[model samples]
Target: MLSNTDIAELLARQAERESGILSRAFRRAARSAFLWPEEVANVIAQNRSLTELRAIGPFIERQIRHWIDKPPHSTHRAPTIRRDFVSLAKARQLLARKPAWAKILRGDLQMHTRWSDGSGTIAEMADAATDRSYEYIAITDHSKGLKIAGGIDEQALKKQGNEIGKLNAFLRKSGRNLLVLRSVEMNLNRRGEGDMSPESLLALDLVLGSFHSSLRIVEDQTNRYLAALRNPHIQILGHPRGRIYNFRIGLSADWPRVFAEATSLNKAMEVDCYPDRQDLNIDLLKIAREHGTHISLGTDAHHPWQLEFIELGLAAALKAKLPADRIVNFMPIGELKSWVREVRGRAPRRP
Candidate 1:
């Protein structure tokens, strides 16, 4: 039976051959495949209409039926933007092969609450993590530099910390083992400088530095990645490439050298698992694995329920055969903190 990915590719190819609203609809249906919760074939086996899926209408449903009946032959390669993303259905299939791997996940390294653009509050996010049985989850809200995302300033960050502390106490009192880690997605400029003060950053449990601007530059970005890795405040580099599916192609760089620098520094490059933003996709992940680079997985979730997105990153890591030892999420809470402390201690003091 064809997976949702196969149906998506068929729709995308069909879209390329047409024009106007019909073509746009096909493209939208293609992108929607990643978000669809069930396999189209399974839905068909149950005698369900394809319109039950997102972005599928009667017309698109009929087209999907045709493809399902007689799958089209894929003659050309998918563009970089649309390639290598594993849908949730596919991720589940891969994880079933090693049931133990999913159980080892202790926490989610990156997420947001209403403190930033996220729709959920800290308490709501915590509740969701508890459902997943995660021992901890980092609240990496946007820092002041990313004003577009309603980034928080130093004072606001401290206030957020207090809130997290209270929540932790409550969880402890309630016999819940979850810890909400304090972290911020500090915005980095093209020069690899972060907007938040170094002192403020040091106060957090962990820090993730990311590039929010100059993402569309077509030139190489090896130097940028190097400088960001060397920045003393950041323990993890978030979404290293800034790529979005079928939209931004992301930056080009000598990835081997980049991963080597990350490895030497003992810092991690994130596998941002957001469906539309699966940066550090499988191809680059293979290189990182070859260099034995530390890999951090984060759903980059804007809402609590989106934590399920981690499966995509986990599957990508599994596909690349990334060693379990190098994956930070596999570490227990204490070990994870120890890794953060080690990296922070090695960073040079800022003036």
Candidate 2:
């Protein structure tokens, strides 16, 4: 039986053999294979159309059927960009083995709302979190530096805080345990400098710093990661690799040194659970485990339902065998907040 990874590699190889729109569609289908909730073979065995899978249409379905019927010898080696990503089916299987792992998760650390580029409003996201029984969810929308994502300015961030405050009060009065954290995905430059002001960041419950530009540089980025970790404004370094499936391979750096720095600083690096962008994948997470660095999980969700994406990160962490004490999302809301406060306390005093 061909696994999802095999199917993805097969499709990718087939894509290379073709050109134009057909090739793009094959490449997209290959990426979508990682996100497909079920194995294509299972669907086929159940007499279901392969089109039921994402990125699959009648044309792609026919091609997939051919591959399934006559297993193709894969010519493509899994590149760094496409390696070690877990399929939804695989994540479910892993979680099934340790049924309590998913239950221990208290909240999602990174997500967005309409205050930025997200499709859902704050109330909608809160309601969704409530549905998931999440103790809290951070609203880490894009900050002003990333205009392309409709990043929010400091004034808008303050306004967003007011909304979060009101929602928290309402939830409290209603006896719901869910809390919405005021946070922003602050854009960081290559120099490890943030785009937003310190005063503005200080007002939020937590801040996530990520690199939004210059991601394609081939040189080692050890100094950049070191500087970002030392930069006091961020408690979590979001998506440290900046990689995207089949699109960008992400940056290179001496990861052990970077992980060690994060460990010494008591900071966390993220496992962004966007299917196509599962940064801090299992390979790197293993290195982090050796360094005893803290791992944070975020769906990088733009809408509420996307919160389910957390499973990918959870599975990645489980596969990495990271210590429960070191995974921040495993903490309850109060403890999670305290961890943030502790990290913030260690941040250098701003001039």
Structural similarity to truth (TM-score) of each candidate: 0.95, 0.97
In order, what is each prediction's RMSD in angstroms? 1.6, 1.3
For all candidates in order, the CA lDDT equals: 0.91, 0.91
Worst 10 residues of 2 by lDDT: 72-81
**Candidate 1 — what's its lDDT?**
0.91
> Tens-digit lDDT track for model 1 on 1-351?
678877777778889898999999999998889878878888899998878788999999988888788876763567777788778878888998998888888989999889999999999999999999999999999999898999999999999999999999999999998999999999999878999988788889999999989999998999999998988889899999999877788888999999999999999999999988888899999999999999999999999899999998998999999999999989998999999999988987656
User: What's the lDDT for residue 275 in model 1?
Assistant: 88
Candidate 2 residue lDDT tens string, 170-238 = 999999999899999999999999989899999988889999899999999999999999999999999
Off by over 4 Å in 1: 14-24
Indicate the TM-score of model 1: 0.95
Clashing pairs in 1: none
